[model samples]
Target: MPANTANVVAEYKDPADFYNLINSDEFSNDVGQMLKSFATARTVPGIYETDVSPKEVFTSPVSEIFRIKIHGDQAKETTARAEWENFTKTLNGKKVLSGVSINLEERLFLGIVGWESFEVSRLLNPFHWARKLKFTGSRKIP
Candidate 1:
């Protein structure tokens, strides 16, 4: 079997907002910074800008999705929200998708870079200098 790559997600107040952010250079810059923050704060193997590429679709029957769960206190969540808002503040446009779900409980966040095959996924996500094991122990690929 081929190895699997992971993905990340974020919640938005409107679909238009999501699209606008995703399409902007500011989004790229902010996301690039966020990924670096994750690597530094979480001490996960750092991923570079060259290592990431956006995709239109992240889920499919054949896809192996990597799920990550963060257990933190409300203070941490509040901090995260502040950081996220700072990144998103660059979005100067209006909301496009109305009635978008903004509830914190209903949202998920995934960070992913699609790989052509499982082998590539495994190779890139090296842990202990071994390509056979998943790199980030916190993430589960099911």
Candidate 2:
């Protein structure tokens, strides 16, 4: 594994369970770990922020997915975390996680450096993660 590689997984028991996790320390801990592992040493460039499914965000069958695609050097991790914090802060205590089955996807990138190129693989293991996650309180390490 590369020194800059970092992986993170966010799991919620059920949609209701997600509410609890988001408000609890677990969410913060997970975010913190992601930042700690991926933060870049310097400011990166060519950062692009886009909303994949704009309408689906509020009307999707599954939970909403917020994805960030960045094209830069080592600082991408820190930048990503900052963006994530800003995005999540606007939830306004809404119930964003609720469903019969939840998918807590996790991924680890092994590279020569901390993201030398731009890559987004949220769909890598769609079926696998979707199958492993269920219920309302189980937590798994990624």
TM-score of each: 0.27, 0.23
Q: Across residues 15-60, which tens digit of lDDT does each residue of candidate 2 receive?
A: 5665565567866688546565566574221111222212223332
* 1-142: candidate 1 lDDT, tens digit per residue: 2235343545443456766765789866987677664443442222212112223323322223322222334553344344434433432321111111122342223223333445645554423221121222233244
Q: Which stretches of candidate 2 lie over 4 Å from their true place?
A: 1-62, 70-72, 95-142
- The numbered model that scores best in lDDT is 1
Worst 10 residues of 1 by lDDT: 94-103
